[model samples]
Target chain A: MAENQGVLVYLEHREGKLLPIALEGLGAGRRLADTLGQRLSCVAIGSNIAQLASQAIAAGADRVYLMDSPELADYQPDIYLALMGQLVAEARPQVIIMGHTDTGREIAPRLAFRFGTVAVTDCVELNIDNTSGRLLATKPVYGGNALAVFSTDTDPQVVTVRTKAMAPAVPNASRQGEVITPAYKVEPSVVRARIVRRVLAESAGVKLEDAAVVVAGGRGIGGAEGFKQLEDLARLLKGAIGASRPPCDSGWISDTAQVGLTGKIIAPELYIAVAISGSSQHMSGCSGARTIVAINKDREANIFRHARFGVVGDWKKVLPAFTAKVKELLAS
Target chain B: MNIIVCVKQVIDPEAPPSSFRIDPATNRAEMRGANPVIDPYGEYAVEAALRLKDAGGAKVTVISLGSNLLREVVKKPLAMGADELILLEDAAYDGGDSYSTALALAAAIKKIGQYDLILCGREASDTNAGQVGAGVAEILSLPCVTLAKRLEAGAGNLVVERVTSAGYDVVEVGLPAVITISNEIGEPRYPTVKGIMAAKKKEPLVWKPTDLGLDASRLGSAGRKVKLLRLYQPVYEGRCEFVEGQTPEEAGANLAIKLREAKVI
Candidate 1:
């Protein structure tokens, strides 16, 4: 049997802020490690992420591995992959967990390939096999119409967990853990990918994932003008405007506002699907919303099945009236 | 320049929920009646390649691994102006997972020999596993960049806009790299009648594992590292309560009132 090793969570950060998914990864890592009676270690790789290392420990990590270097900033794939691969070699975590974000999706599979292991991405649930001690990851397949529970016989099972699926590790403030700063050598010449610039897409109101209410438009919304109404509704609800794949593919909405299997998986308190006939692909992301309200001209739209409230009519006429009512209710 | 884009045929992802049927015997999701389409993201990859070809002279060959049933779907990139299409089809290749798929593609890419770049979609819609592109890169020992929203094939290297959490990163990488194109690449261009006619003339060449010299043990389901125990749809408990009213405004107002009553507002 391959040696039972510790669980490692890859910590992701951007603009000096530890991304929310990192804490979620640690939370997931903590659970697996606890179940297996193994230690949980968080690997923080970035420029000046020492504070993040300590926070990781406070947030439930048993050990924190810090690899701080100027070259680590801005996320050059080559450098990050190299450092992470090397860390995995040295640390030898039996189960590796990462968020199924852009970075995690890129790194987990590649790293698993390098190790001759298997990688399962965007897992909504995970468990340990009692007999083999393998990591069993539950992932959605067939566009979320079904879930496949998979397990890898290869050692050091690597998995990427979807956002909002797991609770994040809350800081205890007094918790302590070992901090290991490994001596790693990454020559700049070996790094092939270089980031020359970065620009954030402009967004207004609440961030989609964090919003209490999400007013998402789909292809039925027609064009950018349809999104304008959604934007107005979102603003009235103190929420954010999101989209299904069509609107984003049509360039009517920014990709950041996209919510689906390939896009951001969100679970707002209330999901207002406007003019969107729900496909399994789009509904996969928003199935977690507490209450879904679908407004579409198509009376037979699949979204009505899952929504808490279904308004069967033209969203163009329905939205304005809906927004006015919401406004009146808010004022009252 | 020779560019290869790995494409796959998948069951339509946009199919309605009622169309999904669980085959209790097989424990897999099956559609009652379905039309297969080129994975949407793969269209973006084709678009990315065509854009590169438009800027400079290049031959784009799209390679897809699936059943012979995908012959029509495989011709999509060809209609989008790709120079050639290679379909890796065989009974042995049936029900292969992503790892097997990548291994087969890597073998095909090696057989093609000379290539400046390889492109793929960020993930396949059916499996939703964004691993095959990176996995192929691993087998070939080549540098890979995933989720490229914008790409420019410069001399000796490529510049790209990589999507990140906060925004996009402009990345520079050498040639002979693998790039997984994202939805941010914009809508794939529809084929003109002329292009469709040209595509019909360019027949796809089908190849089996034996052609690539891949053995039975190292290909298909046998090569898979992960074992699937079961497949089932998640049960969503709630059903929508239809709002009926004399007017749209009344219905909308009642929805608000219901939300207020439920204390969700």
Candidate 2:
């Protein structure tokens, strides 16, 4: 590894608050830096983002590159990429790590192209090869049917680590890192697209992607109304309502609530799959969940193989009891 | 105006789950002959571009970065009324992550300059990175609008409805921009028989890295910054206890009992 080249992590923030995944990226990058025997630096860009820079340092960054610009207050791809591209060119890091969140997903690839390098995305695992002195990345493929390993003998490797793939770092409050406030030049003419408004769904709290617990229903739930009981269970448990593709395609649930390869990838602590057959496509997204409980009337449903616990019964019959019990526990 | 729609051929998402596989040696998906479908998201992209082209009287070009299978995939967009096709084909292009692919695509776009707009799917069904479109936009130094659910032509600009967590945001961007269409935009139109016949007679412009003035070292695995180390199936290790009951109320009670025991309720 080059001396000047270190692991540069992009700190993800929104509306002045730092995203948890950004700290996780800092932790993951710190490990990569340690393995490579290099320093770790982080970059935070957005308007009024100076306060969050310290958090990056606390997470493990040796230095923080700050770029505060009004154009970057919201996520406009052109301005963000331009700012990042400029930073990368100046820093010339061997590896640039980012969180696989909405902002990171949008910026990482764009930055990679501008720097003329490939970016491995949604990586679940990462390691450094001591002998080869190269970084190795792993991600799911074929709708989670297989895992593919890849490596490159090149410089400035770009990677977007998936959320929950690595543990978040313990902040070192005493450690104060160097902060470099970079000069940002953004032309209003360059920002052709503007975010005039942002609308959030009413049930946004239970978004499958960020949920800690997900109660999913499938075709076996019978119809659209079937989701009511599942939603009740989810609400009782303070979890999200998820659905298999069958229900999403059948218009029983919105696509946003679908949990599968084609939809959201979730890693909830507790995943309750009701009447789901456990198709590989669907399994790919929920594979990361810590504990899986499957309920189906058909004892032979494919979901049983991957589920940690399964009840051979109708979800309609099983869900009310589960909800009541959960409510009771919470009440206590 | 010229518009290019990037299309990718993917395994039919509706196909049975048992058909998917990966070729270990090649590090490629073993989906050679299974039913091929236009990536569902890409369909929205193609349709969006076609709408733009028809509205603005622009020449729409369909581009694909893949094998000969692209011949079929590209034709679908052409049949939907794309005027021309460009195929970036080469063995070296395989195993390319989003950034590398975007680099080659940017080079191709520069070679085929004069395009006023570029459209892509928000994310492909396979990798689902949703990065390439933004990557291309970055490489080309162009503005990009992501998750555009609705679009209309405006005076020297494009009015788009961008989806966000809250609701929809209406934004306007001038020409020479990249827009990623969401699946909710609309269903992709079916190719008419006449359009398909016309598409059969059209030959795509095939180009390698060399053709687009890109160095071999900067276009493939060699140029990749990140690598995949390993992929393993996650192990599910939870013990499940069945709650037996003959009636709905009894089943509910049994489930309630189990939840109470687990202290999850």
Candidate 3:
């Protein structure tokens, strides 16, 4: 079978609405496609989501493939894998891109297995090697202690880019593209696991992965009581409260709030580490933070090496003062 | 009823950070010491299955995919009263990621059929992929509940409290389901001395890919869809400014001044 030569970006959507990462993926796919001198294509699979095709074109896709079905409405793995597997088998794009979100995490690995190709996850950056024209993916490894570069000798390089790794494209109202609705068959056996209900996150403002600022606590926070102060500070800063693996392992905090290779990876404008010694596992999740502030009594703490600013003192003294100052500044 | 709990051996969580690394050429994590313990989450799954057996008298089988070193880890679970142990080990399985691992495990599970329930850790401490449980569930055509912090077996269904970012959700699924236990589940029990003594004489059934009817190509790196290219430590370019003053109050003032200067306050 002759394979599709263009770059294909998977457009992720929920409840019939496109996600921000989809646009980012399109922007990235378009750039790679332009470099390869091929057209940019996108695949959108969900029920009654034809309206999303226009958005993909507006972002830079030259062609859009739509796989609409009622079975896809809820992100059942069987239905999604079957539909996406069929699309990839037919389209055979030289490269496939997806967002490193919940959906991408679940589907990409399985799709890669079905296709017999590599799918790099949580890539922070993607570019085509000028010499080989192969996709070069860079991601953090060993909990964020290191950055790894990967490239494949095979065609159809599949990768999932981290959110905000690429900038969203400028909306071009005049841009147009061909929207092909592919016909697919949903195997009765494919719908094995069903999502009975989606539990929405409590905080409506921002998730730790998407937050601009992150304030994290560690064993130095004393105990469960310290999180109350941390929560107040996080709210005042309009940021999210994160924790080292210790607190989460100790059951003081939820695993979702854990900041490490095992937890949520976060890249923010500023990361404030309170009494965190900055283990490599914790560091992997926040290596992308532009500026890091460390407050610890141990002057030899490893976290100081990664911090843009450091305060060698007790957080008990530093946190209250820091919180008050931030409050005062916001008030002014 | 038959049950299989997939367990792995991992470095103790309290181990120092410098102890964890992978040999670049081999692409396998290097274990610094023999202090490896049963992955915390895996222990939870084992305990949950044991509890189920204690209540319903179902047969419990503990299955692990790793080297002979896993025998040490399996001993603890066996002492906890599991009936049988199966270890899937081979050189080809080395450097395999989550998908391939799941594929091999699914093949093993298929060979050992008539299982009423399968339990797995929500995520492994090493790869932290959190995909194998779901992947196995997909391949086996079984319903799965990921990140179940609390679980109970009912008359005809399984009742679970699944943890998510929002909070916990109460869910009910029929039997013959897969449930991945979270750390939020209670701590695993330690093996008793009597149980440990008995585990010493118990031999675990070892199998290779051929034994389980899995294609060799689908059991290792070749079966993996994700590959690690190169890994290097993150570079720290930021310089820290240490605030100094005579007293705590003065140091606080100096810190405030620095924050104001940066406009971060």
Candidate 4:
């Protein structure tokens, strides 16, 4: 079992397409593997992912393991866990990596616990300590107010990297790797939870998570109507509209648009925060953004402190004018 | 039916960023004038439990493991509709990471011995580590699900709507299972004046680690399986210039030009 020891990355895909975070995980795994002088391997579980296995090799894995089954067409925690547990028992990899998505966060710890270990979730940075030769995981704690570095004495360090933290691996079309189709079985009767339905939230235009430039509204926007201005601004900027917890809680926007500690963490190149007083919780999600511009009527608003540029005025007056300016600039 | 909800008291998530500082010496946060509150997601869990109670007859017992100061925050769930509160207040439980915290919580729940269901927040705001729910379930040998947006009771089972990456999944799990509720469950209800008055009469029973038939030595940092090596703040280093303009339109135009010049657009 120790013969396959190396770094194993969990590759997540949907609709036969590899996820962005999966590539990111591979990139991270490659770096860690190179540093540890071990080979980088990737594991994907689904009904049809052999094409994805080839993509993993191009994306930097030296080896790819595919667990194909009809039952895995959609994500069922029970089936997926059973498959992964069998793989880990047989492969005995030194390190395991996954993206800190909903699935990863839900499964990593339980998987680690089954092996009598613990997982470090939502890690922003990972490195091997030169002295101890241990994986050092750095993650945000206290709602992104502080960073804590963690190390475990246990073998097979399990970690879930946060989204947008690591650069995705560049595809090398000529790269080659081994594809092992591991034989695993999942019993349906053991799975107590069964998916009766899946309701997808309707997404309008650009998803907030993928938008490069985001125009976000807050409670100061007043109500749902105020978000229309932001929507107009977002359209003009060719970006997406985001919201603080207050606006989302107020029903002005869907919870999906919430950018905060409890919401989605985004790392767009530019962020335009409007009328949002920055609390630590809200700022945590946007802290990774490269540039921030804040517009708030209150001069003392906490958002201004984090913004790279600030405008103090009534947003009712500012938003429309700002939208017009953006329109003019784009048109010209 | 009876249920147990695990609540944690953490520094207010709404506190301004500048109010937090880390002591590198001890690898911990230095709270400055920031009041502690029940974890926001935990409130949602309590709300989920209370909704179930409203629908049927159920007794909800809220449990927390932290400093004695947590008494102020744990009472919140009681005011919101929990029947009783139990605080595992002792110095032995201080600075315990999620694994140890779950161990202590699981021990407490086993002692309670009447819960048909167990619920907790998706994660505590302060630690931001979401291992406790699964860890508790692992220790208790119960089925578990995370990030549940909605839950309803069924015949000998529970129906849960869990939020997945692409959508929500409708799931059914057997009774005596653990569920970690997400904020999508909806806003927690505020305590009415009468509920607040009722809470005053329901004093939380304090328990030590030994009271739950657990070893005090295996309760806090000593019991933690993971080691925190360091703690520090990420430097903001962002320098923002105030945009000058006579009218809001003028500032907007200037800001746009500045962004264009910086090649950020």
What i-RMS does every model get? 1.4, 3.6, 3.4, 1.7
Instruction: State the lDDT at A218 in candidate 4.
Output: 91
Give lDDT tens digits, candidate 1, residues A136-206: 89999888888999998876789999998988888787988999999888878766677888788887778
| Local accuracy of candidate 2 as per-residue lDDT tens digits, B1-265 | 6788887877775554555555556545545457677787888888888777777677888778865564666578888888888888887776666767888888888988888889999888777678789888878878888878888887778888876533467878888889988866766889999999999999888998789888878666655555655544444443456667787557766766665566544
Best first by DockQ, ranked: 1, 4, 2, 3
**Minimal lDDT window, size 10, model 1 chain A:** A70-79
The interface RMSD for candidate 2 is 3.6
Higher-lDDT candidate among 1 and 2?
Answer: 1
DockQ of each two-chain model: 0.74, 0.44, 0.35, 0.68
Q: Rank order by TM-score, top first?
A: 1, 4, 3, 2
**Residue pairs of candidate 3 with colliding backbone atoms:** A94-A156, A118-B225, A119-B225, A143-A284, A144-A284, A146-B232
lDDT per residue as tens, model 4, B114-226: 88899999998888889899888888878888899889999989999997645678888998999999888888999988888889888888989779888877888888778
- Stretches of candidate 2 exceeding 4 Å from the true structure: A1-4, A14-17, A69-72, A204-212, A219-224, A244-265, A279-281, A296-302, A312-332, B31-33, B50-59, B70-74, B78-100, B103-114, B165-169, B190-256
Best by DockQ: 1
The fraction of correct interface contacts reproduced by each prediction comes to 0.78, 0.58, 0.36, 0.66
Name the docking class for model 4. medium
Candidate 1 DockQ vs. native: 0.74
Give Cα distance to truth, residue B119, candidate 3, Å: 2.9
Each prediction's TM-score versus the true structure = 0.96, 0.84, 0.86, 0.96
lDDT of 3 at A137: 86
Interface RMSD of 3: 3.4
> What is the C-alpha lDDT profile of model 3 across B107-223, one tens digit per residue?
899999879899998777665556688778768767777778777787867887776545656666777988888766767778899888889899989899889888878777777
Per prediction, the TM-score for chain B is 0.95, 0.85, 0.86, 0.95
